[model samples]
Target chain A: MLKESLSSFLRGCRTWRLWTLLGWLDIQQRYARSSLGPFWITLSMGVMVGAMGLVYGTLFGQDMKSYLPLIGSGFVLWALISGILNESCFAFINNANFIRQSDVSLWVYIFQVLWRQMIILAHNVVVIVVLRIVFNVKGYDHLLLFIPGLLVLLLNLTWMSYMAAIWSARYRDVPQLIASCLQILFYITPLMWWPHMLKKHQWIITINPFSSLVDLVRAPVLGAYRSQLAGVLPLFLL
Target chain B: MAEAGDGAIQVQCLKDINLSLDKGDRLGLVGENGAGKSTLLRVMAGIYRPQEGCVKREGKTVPLLDISLCLDDNATGRQNIRLRGLFLGLSSEQISAHEQEIISFSELGDHIDMPVRTYSTGMRMRLAFSISMAVEAEILLLDEVLAVGDSAFQAKATARLREISDRAGIVVMALHSSPAIMKFCNKVAWLQDGAVRMLGECHEVIRAYDQFMHSKEKTDA
Candidate 1:
């Protein structure tokens, strides 16, 4: 079973054209007949971060200057992570027709799901850029680091999607359970709240791998890294 | 019986099956409902993994279990032709070369430019059959999907199948009608309860199956 899964993964990677076309089709099919099409994601992200930046800034008693960029980038990266996780659960199930009919490697569907989510993330990145300019966050020196960080995050998501899609296909309820778990993990993670909010109990967030993952992407983009080594070391090991 | 995830005893859909086909072979599969005819074809097609035993194929294989497989309903019929052909292991160049032929063969004309969902069921079937038949393969597997179209279209589909069979090295088809089997296959495998009950010349095996069914029917009466 391990050998088959590994081979499927390699074949899936090799068949980039197939997955790319399917992923592009997925976006087109989704926003079909809409004016803005997939840009609707971009629009919603812009409004969400703009509104949340103000409300959460007041609620947390932080200056909008720093908090807006922090929350904005944080939410965008979180969406990429959680979106991959959530969508992977249905990857195989959704492609049941292809699976039963075609002999393409099963990993193709997993990659297709991840690729489609990445396309949506690309749209949401527009919001991230706007926030960065508005907040004037700086750290151009660390900007190149974001590329490697994103690559590592994508690698992790590939394996996670592979396992999740298979397990969820068999269990059927795993997607729902994962949905609820993500709902709670969202509050626990430092997406909206600052890490300093935990104070001495910061170990709580440090121990949670999700925080490190977010910081991996969010910190570099914001030109800051609160424990750069700490945030990225575990992911390297993963 | 296999143990399902919830601890329920689930009957194995296929078991204790062993058969082989070689180059220049055409085999017809005939069986009652739930007799594992489709399951065996799926296993050969590499869609379903068998719990026991193994299936090995030498060259490229295409399964026509469902004509609409890999077709995007929202995409134009022409696009679906390319997409379905790709899934069947045809390169873009090959599909493009056959594009015009497939369109004319399906007789879709202007409708080929329209989304597949906008076409009727018969039109979709024609599109699927045309594209699938266009892919040259070492092995071809078919289910009941060929039972398509009116008499005129069936005649065309039959000719298409004959052309494909002449080119393909191996053909394994699961079909219901003895006449269809007699028309295409040179060998036959009769499956009963997931096991092969008879395997021999097409007429011999199918005649045995016919005898068994007729005697059983008389007993019931």
Candidate 2:
């Protein structure tokens, strides 16, 4: 099972070039008739963050620069997680033709969705970058670590996408259940909050599969990492 | 009882499961809706492995399961023909040489540059059928997918299919319209309730299927 999943994901990643182009094809197809085109995602993200960040920044008594990265990082990571989970659940079902007919590898469709999300997230990052500059936010030197982290997250997400698509295709209920779990995890996750402030129950943040993921990547990017941040390995971070 | 629940399709939905076709024969499958007719063709095409018995194919099996499996809706018709042809099992060079023939055959005109989504369903089928012909594979399987074309276009499409079968491919078309079947297929297999009720001359199987239905009605009454 592991070998199959691994092979499927590797095939998926290798097809990244074609699928990424296909993902762009879909984006054009989706947004072509509309007036706004592809900015709908980033536009909506901007509106939501501006409102929430203003209200929450005051509530938390934080500056926009400091707070915006918190929101920016959270949103980027959430988009990655949410996009993968949302699309993978229906991957096989949606590509029934490719599943039943295409001679090419079935894993190509998984990469198709993952690349689609990465593209959309790349668009949304423009919003985040704009917010950071607009708010005078400073970039973390360790932000360079995000390149590796993004690489790792994508590698893992490819595996998850394959396993999820195949699993959901068979079990029937796994897709719906996974969708709800993702929604709940978004709220439970500190998307807009500081990880350190949850000192009383930081374990909740630390134990999350995405927690290590977000901490290792996002904190460093937002320049929020303390000297002790490097010591924050998987288990002991909380 | 050819039961296959775990993704292993063992039962060939073909009933009667017996037929003999001379070389260069065109046969249609005609029946009412929900008939096991398409399943029969799929079984023949190796898309659905039969559960109960076995199927023998002297040549390769290819089915028009979907158009986009070969052509993405957003791609140009020119590219789609090559893509779809390659998908149907042609090598890239083979696809390259045949691309022009399929494109011109589609009669898509200047619209060939447009994405396939802009084309009507009939036009899409035209493009799909033309590409399938280019592959030069034996044993063609289609399922009422031809009705999408205009009547004149249908005649040309039928002629292309007929010519291909005459040269090589063994044709098995699952259709509901008896007239269309008669126009194309010299042999027909009648299927109902996942069993082959008759497999013989097109008219004979049609007659048998009709009689069976009439008897069923009398019994129900």
Clashing pairs in 1: none
What are the TM-scores, per candidate, against the unseen true structure?
0.94, 0.75
Model 1 TM-score relative to the real fold: 0.94
- Put down candidate 1 lDDT per residue, B1-221, tens digits, no spaces: 77988796877777677777877788999988888888888899988877777899998888878656567888889878877876776777898899999999989999998988888877888888788777777788888777766678878987766666676478888888999899888999999998888999999999999898889899999
| Model 1 segments more than 4 A misplaced | A225-238, B1-6, B218-221
Best by TM-score: 1
For candidate 1, write residues A1-238 as lDDT tens digits.
8898789778778877777778888898889899999999999888988898899899989999898888888888888888989999999998888888888888888888889989999999998888788778777887778877788778877877888899999898899998898888888899998888877787779678778777777778988755455565666565
Candidate 1 overall lDDT versus native: 0.83
Worst 10 residues of 2 chain B by lDDT: B7-16
